[model samples]
Target: MKKLVVMGGGIGGVASAYELKQAVGSDHEIILVSDNPWFEFTPSNPWVAVNWRKPDAIRVDLDEAMSRRGIRFIHDPVVRVRPADDQLDLSSGTVLDYDMLVIATGPRLAFDEIEGLGPEGFTSSVCKTDHAAATAQVVEKLCEAPGPVVIGAAQGASCYGPAYEYAFILETELRRRKVRDRVPMTFVTPEPYIGHFGLDGVGDTKGLMESELRERHIKWLTNHRIDRVESGVMHVTGVKPDGSDAESSTLEFAHSMILPAFTGIDAVMGIDGLSNPRGFIPVDEFQRNPTYANVYAVGVCVAIPPVGKTPLPVGVPKTGFMIESMVTAAVGNIALALAGEEPRHRATWNALCLADFGDRGVAFLAVPQIPPRNTNWSSSGKWVHLAKVAIEKYYLHKVRKGTTEPFYEKFGMKLMGAGKLRGQA
Candidate 1:
């Protein structure tokens, strides 16, 4: 029997595992290895950061969930990956052999790249459930003693939606507590424009986002990079389109949360033909590694180029829907490989995002996450916030049940009609 191993326990990893099992059935052995024991609904992290959702409420015990599906679960961290030998060494001195390896081990937050960044330093983060829970305490403290607030993504960061979500959500919470008037909020980012989002303003997102910021009385700095974050102060540099320095300034804040750039995890880093310079796995359209055909990757661990160039680096985001497509494509390719057939399936890489702002939210759909898409749409309303909440609960329930069905394809597509556009090309 063929042995397949999927790494990581995030959305992509769990989804891949469930899908792989369904595709291969009981004929092949399927194993899921994760550093953590719980599957976190990451999109709800902004809510967690503001105490709207508890950490336990958004997390699922992966050990129990995977057990019901007849899959072996390893809760140990992977220490190293030896692609040449098709082997993985775990931190607990255990080794695993696999005929096929699916990498869904999401990015390693690169907070260390910047001085005084991250929870260990001067700022807070909402990247993980624990991080969000801890940040909620900080948010409570901010409400108690209101002051300036800084919320944005660092240079080279790809995930801008959470940064925007946190900014607006926190603003909403502060306003609810009647402390917003005392807190002057500023959004700083590496995007060339207000809503570049690394994919370059989807469907007038620039206008909508800028308008939202203005309406909320929040200031912004685009094409800006944080040089260093000192306690209660942020050193920032502005960059011109020509890559020249535009301005250098320092802003003081009582609280801050900066989303750091992401890189591949340590286990897969520096593998000669498996990973790129940034430690991200380089995969073809079918989500199979070019050098190692037996290797496939999905989620934030996969390498995708930026949509275009900007003054500051802005990596493309692998949204939840896009990652779902990747997982489906990778699992299909693996099934074909088991049958001794060549890889053929390809992921559409389309993006559909719901950026919640507490009482209201923004939703966007890009036919193909890259620019020049057949369909590019974005809208904002209270419905979006409600939709995000519903999706979070539905997704968590789906994960617990080990359902391999594609949630976004089945629900989001019919809701937005973007799936019809995918049939065009």
Candidate 2:
């Protein structure tokens, strides 16, 4: 039997593993390697940072879940990847060889890109479950002693949805505690505008997000690059449209959560053409690495260029929906390769997001994640918040049950009507 290995345990990795197993069944051996033993629902991380959801509520024990599907689970960190040899070296002195390797290891948080950033430094983060749990305690302390709050993404940071969600979620929480009036909030981002989101304002996100921030009285500084952070203060340099520095300012805060930039994991970095300069895996349309045919990648670790130019660097976001599309296409192509056939599947990189505030939220659907799309729509309401809550639970359930079905294709098609996706590349 051919042995196939999948790395990482995030949405992309887990989905790829399950789908691969279903495609080949017991005909081939499938193994999933992860640094951690549990699969944390990452989208729920913002809520965890505020104690809205406990850590346990969103994590699935990977070992138990994978065992039920007859997939071997390895809980060891990868030290290095020898793509040419089709081998992986683990931190525990174990070596693995595979006929096919799917690298779904998510991006490494580049907190060190800025001084005094991330959980180890001055600011808090909601990128990981552990980080979120720790940040939740900080949130409690902030509520007891209210002051200024600074929230936003740092320079080169791609993911902006959670930053926006955290800003509003915290605002809603503080209001519930009756301390919001005393806490002055400010949002600082590298995007040229409030909702650039790396896809250049998908579905009127610019107008909707700006309106939300204005109504909530959250002051903002767009096109701003964080220079550094000290205790209770952040130094920022404002950028002009010509990619030049304009003004310098310092923001004082009692609490702050800044999303840092992302890079590929150390194991896969600087491996010839396997990864980009920033270490993100470069994939063809079929999600297979161009230099290494057997190497497929998905999720945030995969590299895609920014949608447009801006004052500062902005990376494209691989939303959950887009990642699911990648996983589906990768699995299909792998199955074709196993059967000695040419690969033909290509994933549709659509973007779907449910950005939740505590009381309400916004939903965005872009038929194609990039601009010049066929369908671009966005709406906001309490229903959006409720839908996100339901999705979190459903996604966790899917993981636990080892379901291989793609979630986004059906959901997006129904949400936008079937006609939007018909006759597209």
Candidate 3:
């Protein structure tokens, strides 16, 4: 019997295991290893940061959930990934050998790339559940003594949705606390313009998000390169579209949350031809590592080039739906290989995002996520906020049950003219 080992228990990892177990039948052994014992619903992290959600409400026991589906689970962190020998070393001294491997370890928060940033530094973060909970505590403290606030993403930060979401969520929370007036809020980002979202301003997202920020009484600074963060102050260098110096200033703030650049996790970083300089796994269109055919990657762990060049670095986003498409393609190809067929699955790699801002939000769609695409559209409404919440709940439930491609989400996406990656050539 073939042994299929999936590393990382994030959305892509869990979903990949589910699809593998179902497709491979009971003949193959499958196991998922994750550093954390519980799976956190990442999409709700912004809400968690503002006390709108308790961490426990959006998390589930990874071991129990996977065991129910006849898949093994390990909570030990990966020590090293020896792709040459198909060996996986764990922190607990367990060495796992796999016939096939799926890598979904997710992004390594590159907090150290920026000095005095992240939770360990002077700012807060909504990247992880614990970080979000900590930010919530800080929010309460801010309520008692409101002051200047700053929220934004650093250079080369790919996942820009959460930054936007956190900004608006904080705004909502501050307003609800009746301390909005006291807290002068600012949104600073490395994008050339507001709402670039790492996709070169998808379908009027610039106008929609700019208007939202304006209507919410929030100020913004784009093409802003953060030099560093001192206590209660962020040094920023504003750049023009041509990469020339435009302005420089120091902004003081009582509270701040800046998303940092992301890189590959340590286990698989610098693996010869497997990864790029930033530690992100470089995979072919089928999500298969070009150097190692047995290895596959999905989600933030995979490398994606920037949408376009800007004065300040801006990486493209791999939205949830796009990640799902990746998971589908990777597993489907693995199934084909097990059936004595060549790997042949292509992911649509489309992006659908809902950036909730408490009471209302903005939504966008990018078919074939990369630029020069066929479809690009964006809009806003209160319904977006409601949809975001529902999606969070739905995804958490699906994780708990170990059911990938929930019928409702799958059918709903299809009904809305959304498509997942499937076998093509």
The whole-model lDDT of each prediction reads 0.92, 0.92, 0.88
Q: What does candidate 2's lDDT look like per residue over 65-84, in tens digits? A: 99999999999999999999
lDDT of 3: 0.88
Candidate 1 ranges beyond 4 A from true positions: 417-425
Error of 3 at 118 (Å): 0.8
How many clashes show up in model 2? 0
Across 201-264, the per-residue lDDT of candidate 3 in tens digits comes to 7788999999999998999999998888989999999998789888899989999999999999
Off by over 4 Å in 3: 406-425
Error of 3 at 188 (Å): 0.4
Q: Which scores greater on lDDT, model 2 or model 3?
A: 2
For all candidates, what are the clash counts? 0, 0, 0
Better lDDT candidate (1, 3):
1
Query: Model 2: how far is 175 from its true place, Å?
Result: 0.3
- Summarize candidate 1's per-residue lDDT along 96-137 as a digit string, tens digits: 999999999999999999999999999999999899999999
Candidate 2 differs from the real structure by a C-alpha RMSD in angstroms, to one decimal, of 2.0
